[model samples]
Target: MELSPVLLYGEAEGMVRSLQSFPLRDTGSGGWLKQHEYIEKLNMQAILNASAGQEEMIKDLLVTHGKVSSLIRELITVEIWKQKVFPVISQLQDFQPRSTFPLYMVIHHEATIINLLETILYHKDVCESAEDLVLDLIDYCHRKLTLLLSRCSAGEIAGQDRLLPSSASETSSLEELKLQAESLEFDVALKCLSVLRYITDHTDSLPLSITTRLLNTHNLPCVLVELLHSCPWSRRSKGQLQKFESGRWLSVPAEDQQKMTKLDGQVWISLYNLLLRPECQQKYNIDGFTRALISSHRDPHRSAAEPSGATAISQLFVSERTGAPKEGADLRAGSRSLGLHYQREFWEMEGDSEAPGEACVLPQ
Candidate 1:
């Protein structure tokens, strides 16, 4: 009987090369996000092939999507766990506290490379078993995102070009993830608690390197804060110097790193808890949400969620620079913003009456 070649006999590589080498044409209009995602899927397939003891195959994969940073990160992260890593992870967790932070961060980052590994585990594309590996990948993203947010404040990733946005939908998703993380009833990781809080409070005050990398992800110029820092300070204009401009990492002086860490991560936890509670649901009305947030400290005065009074900016954080004073005076003008913001908008519109009444979801 004919058997498969011990090595590749033009079965996988030769068959797939044509699809791999074709230059993509400009497809107008429809969000090519799907196209890119498909490309990523193919790229991931190449990576899986490379893992099957084929360096040349991996090289081919790299050549196709070398410039895609996300793809590269996912690829590297997934590829790092050929052997058992759980014991190594536990070792890092138990090591010296200061070093443990960075070490675990590394492990988590590597493990979380493939965000959709869970969904793709059952996919028939890869010939080998990937269940154990895919679960590990999801575990890594959760671990890293949680640890980095908990241990390092926005200060670390905030200033970085590749910095993740503090308000990213993923932060909200993390709150939901907590339910799943705890579904097993294992002791929920304290790091998870800290990171959730930080995300909710919008605390991006991490180390300069981390923050810079995180910010860099948003395509903001890396030197933005630096340029602000280098702005000349004058005797006459002394008050204009600000936190970021002045290179102050934290928006305001904090009691301690631990306190800031807890506060920053708790916002989402609280939001999630409130959202899941029946008490919040009873009063949840679309039109009143903005106002309810503004007057959150008090109970609703009416059936509506927000109090019957005019709204306040719930937490709009802005540094205000005022007029200069005398020497040793408060001349360094600046305002430091932190936490959630409060905004109120009132609008009057005149338009064609085809659609007459605007829908307003009033609190019951």
Candidate 2:
């Protein structure tokens, strides 16, 4: 019986060779200029191959060849360039370029590297391969998520529905390129969410510094709760449920409207891992505001049969463990059990459920 080669044959060497010439820093040198395109192509190919059930080769290329850190560095470099260089280019009078496509590519670079990272970072070894730079990545994702939260809070957020301005032109100009970057922000933020979730998934293998950064330094749970409240990916449009997917918002069918999107599931699953893990629970402070936000989202009238709701989660969890009562166990005794207290309150609250047309509320 023939078997696949152990090393993915030629692809690994080519990617490694490409990395050898890839600039550690984005200095405007001839080598960097030539290698930049090659790097982008390699990243795109990695993503494409990884998605096509050929992840091992790409994973080996990233983790074995030590490309994860390089990817992170390049990602940060592009972000710095966008912040520092792009504006200067935009503001200069004599810097008229034939096409803004090159600049758009630079802005798009961060997202591309992040896409690759997201694809591979699912593996625990890939997460560990990041080493100390994982803290840098944590900080990077924090910056993006916090910027998104600040924009959302300030009402400056671009609508998911309107990815581009009404006047975006076919021709590539600085103004149009800026619009493209702004449009990409939503996608970048979503990618950040996924990266953060992957980090949470592998907290066991990650260092304390990473955990401290996530829980204490960033207070990301609160940030995520804010995200849930804002729900930038979801909207009610003309009584239709529209959700952002594959770069645009589409109407959700009635049957699937209550189902969780990938974005929502990522947030909730991260919360579950971070909150329920023994180590994480010990470290994370479950304060009053946090408790209330969680409890408030639960409605007892909801059942596990429902598509997606916190109450459904509670019901499903209880039903799984509440199978047979212990001998001489007071069924009522279970009612006030700390574990079931929240679920019971949720039921009591549902007894006086809010009136129709009531605005959905979140805890302060």
Q: Which tens-of-lDDT digit does each residue in 106-216 have in candidate 2?
A: 777777778778877867888999899899998999898888878877887454443244456554477777767887776788888889988987887678777788887
Against the true structure, what is every candidate's RMSD?
A: 21.9, 10.0
Candidate 2: list runs displaced more than 4 Å: 1-8, 20-30, 157-166, 170-172, 236-239, 298-364
My TM-score estimates for the predictions, one after another, are 0.21, 0.75
> How well is each residue in 205-298 modelled by candidate 1, as lDDT tens digits?
2223322222232211111122112221111113331222111223333232112122222322233222222233223332344334433433
Which 10 consecutive residues of model 2 have the lowest summed lDDT?
Answer: 355-364
Q: In model 1, where do residues sit more than 4 Å from their true spots?
A: 1-135, 162-364
- Model 2 per-residue lDDT at 115: 79
Candidate 1's TM-score reads: 0.21
Candidate 1 structure lDDT: 0.28
Q: Considering summed lDDT, which 10 consecutive residues are worst modelled in model 1?
A: 335-344
